[model samples]
Target chain A: MKKLIFIFVLLIFSFSYAYQFYGIPYLQQVNDFSLINQDGKKIKFSDFKGKYLLVFFGYTYCPDVCPTSMLRISDVLDELGDYKKYVKVLFISVDPERDTPKALKKFISFYDKTGKYIVGLTGKPEDIKKVAKQFRAFYQKVPVKNKEVGYLVDHSAYIYLVDPKGIIRMIYRPDNDDPKRIAEDIKQIIKMFGTGE
Target chain B: MKKFIIFLLTGFIFLAYGNEIIIKDPWIRAVPPSSKNTALFMTIVNKSDKQDTLISVKTDIAKIVMIHKTVEENGIMKMKHVDSLSIPPHSEVKLKPGGLHIMIMGLKRPIKEGEEVKINLFFKNSGNIEILAPVLRR
Candidate 1:
């Protein structure tokens, strides 16, 4: 009886602490879309093949959220240092009207300096809508009167972590703490069930 | 140490508690060439014992004052009104670009480029903090 009770207590303690480990696991992962990169190279998500994708959506006109969030992502990857060997970040633009293949390329370089390069993609608004819908991301334009023809874009702030097979392993909610922590979380996921010992 | 903190907190229950409740990093992006609406952001740290409220804000540039939060619904960013913001003791509330931000509506006149806006922040504790937001075309 004493041995059984001790085993039960250990089981309960492990369950509570071990489950909240990495990021959020989502229902569906985004796959298969042809979008233009910053280099004007027409590419598809399938091209990435076998790396973890930290997928995010926004436009160049976004005043705060996009830049701040992208900056944070850059910081996270910088903290990752060499672990970037296992990671690739994909940035999709919701505003394709102005974010041309040329602009998308320019905008990304402004933020991410690593040159591992953030894939900046844009397509027809309809195509962009389909890509975002697949991943359960949302974006809407708030128009102002003659406000430079560009207003504001609001979209979901989910940093999706996908596995080697393009399956989403987890989701990161909107957080502005340390980018390095995000890198650690990605490593933790990749190292799951493996020998961190 | 835990018991000591609990006892100390229980003893200070009047007038004020902690020394926080003030917002930090309050700023807005530089307005566009033809735009008048500018946003303000900061962190509200409440270190005092009593609960404080951010009642209103005053600026020499705008005729109307409003509090707003930007929320993402179905992927679209929506800006809406926020009533009085509460500042609790020992905790900090951040007013950032995508989160809770102050909306300066209806400019008194054109906030000329390279000028500055003096913002007067008022709290329920009757304490005031002023910050200068440079108006540049960033």
Candidate 2:
């Protein structure tokens, strides 16, 4: 009877564990690259070694998805509370031609209320493309009808969660639009990776 | 007496046709001044037994407004312009983030939080209705 009860409990636990959440664990190791941050300073990927980085690739001109994702990341950071100290959000602009260091600084600062953990990065078009390719991301520029608006970019909307050791641990999909769930996932990753709360 | 009869007929017609669709929680996410495109969100409920199609949206704040659907194809998110959206009978259709939305392009002016923007939505069966969507900071 004791053995049967233990097996039943294990079965219940396994059933619950089979359920999946919003973010997907990719487990692909990330490579480091140097890019200019929002402060006009050249920062290397190694500079963020000990911190969990929430990386998102978007342009400054993107009004809906980019801003909404940034806001969601900010909300997750806020919900992390004291644990927020361990996390850093990076906004990498794919539109290198238009999104200069100054443009990125102004655009990223608008969404972040605290403005401490969030940082914007932009580099040369080639470098940006190379970095995006390393992460298996895609972006394309399409011309629009308006003369004033030259073009708009269609890109992947996945937000990547990088561990302290620079591994792409989890990815928040565009369809998974809940911020609170993302906070919970971050906490889970921190605990699993033994990265200090 | 003739005027009263005409008013009663109009009221009956409105009750039969116009009062079926209810617009709820309509709002636009506030964007920075430099950003050019923004999306509008709302929950539209069809209370009547018949279905309705949302044909188009118009706003003075923007030069063109298109109904768009965001789809994830091969892990890349892309927005496709849709002609009309169907709202089933006794059902609700939500225009939310990362889903269906009204895409406002060519912003004439920057929108601020708490500012009300007037929008006209034209439907195939229910005709046109005006909504004042408050600019909300998300």
Query: Which candidate gets the maximum lDDT versus the true structure?
Result: 2
Error of model 2, residue A172, in angstroms: 1.8
What DockQ do you compute for every candidate structure?
0.13, 0.49
Error of 2 at A157 (Å): 1.4
Per-residue CA lDDT of model 2 for B36-72, tens digit only, reads: 7788999999987789999999999998788988777
DockQ, cand. 1: 0.13
Chain B, model 2, TM-score against the native? 0.88
Candidate 2 local distance difference test against the native: 0.83
Worst window of 10 by summed lDDT in candidate 2 chain B? B10-19
> What's the distance in Å from true for residue B43, model 2?
2.0
**How far is B52's C-alpha from truth in model 1 (Å)?**
13
Per model, how many backbone clashes are there? Answer: 23, 0
- Interface root-mean-square deviation, each candidate: 6.0, 1.6
What TM-score did chain B of candidate 1 earn? Answer: 0.75
Interface RMSD of 2: 1.6
